[model samples]
Target: MIFMYMSHLECPKCGATYDPHKLTQLCACGSPLLVRYDLDKVKANFKKSDLIGA
Candidate 1:
């Protein structure tokens, strides 16, 4: 299994966070949700070249 770096989904307007595993679209505040990641986990191993074939 591959480990993912995504932390959670957050609402920009209300600053609310939701689980990324569940089905969701807009936040309760009626604002679009944003994806938040644990960049610290990927920063050391990720690079632009990783997306070349993906």
Candidate 2:
């Protein structure tokens, strides 16, 4: 089993985008940028059984 997570930084206020690999204090418009991830990919790459450690 392998565990990994990929994400991207998105600013809700200014609609700005940033790389998730780097550290950012806030968006250019003075709004907090949060990390977003792909849910469909997560469901495809992993299984519920895997989470149970079976």
Candidate 3:
């Protein structure tokens, strides 16, 4: 089974789009990809106490 909550992917170098639900690696052109979050939704559904401190 795969966890599929991720919404979008943005390239660190060229800012390209990819499927967030799929397994991915650094782009062939040489850059990292970052996962984006819906902050409002996350905040509405979760609280500060729900997370562990570093």
Candidate 4:
């Protein structure tokens, strides 16, 4: 089963993509990276109560 549908990591500048499970840092192109998530799965599977210390 996929883990939380954490789809992937992407660089907005160079459009480079990386696996979410591995250790990641600045993109190879020397730009900051961004996180992308599977919002569909999150909306369906997650709830406000799932938040911790809320």
- What shift in Å separates residue 1 of candidate 4 from its native position after superposition? 16
Segments in model 4 whose C-alpha atoms lie over 4 Å from true places: 1-5, 47-54
Residue-wise C-alpha lDDT for candidate 1, range 1-54, written one tens digit per residue: 123887899999999999988857799999999888888777745665476647
Rank by lDDT, descending? 1, 4, 2, 3
List the global CA lDDT of all models.
0.80, 0.76, 0.66, 0.80
Ranking by TM-score: 1, 2, 4, 3
At residue 16, candidate 4 shows an lDDT of 100
TM-scores, one per candidate: 0.70, 0.67, 0.56, 0.67
Candidate 4 CA-lDDT value: 0.80
Tens-digit lDDT track of model 2 for 1-54:
222454678999988889877878599999999878867678766786587877
**What TM-score does model 1 achieve against the real structure?**
0.70
lDDT of 2 at 23: 79
The local lDDT score (0 to 100) that residue 3 gets in candidate 2 is 23
- Candidate 3 Cα outliers beyond 4 Å, as residue runs: 1-5, 47-54
Candidate 4, 27: how far from true, in Å?
1.1
The number of the candidate with the highest TM-score is 1
Instruction: Residues 1-54, candidate 4: write the lDDT tens digits.
Output: 446778888999999998888858689999887888888887766665466435
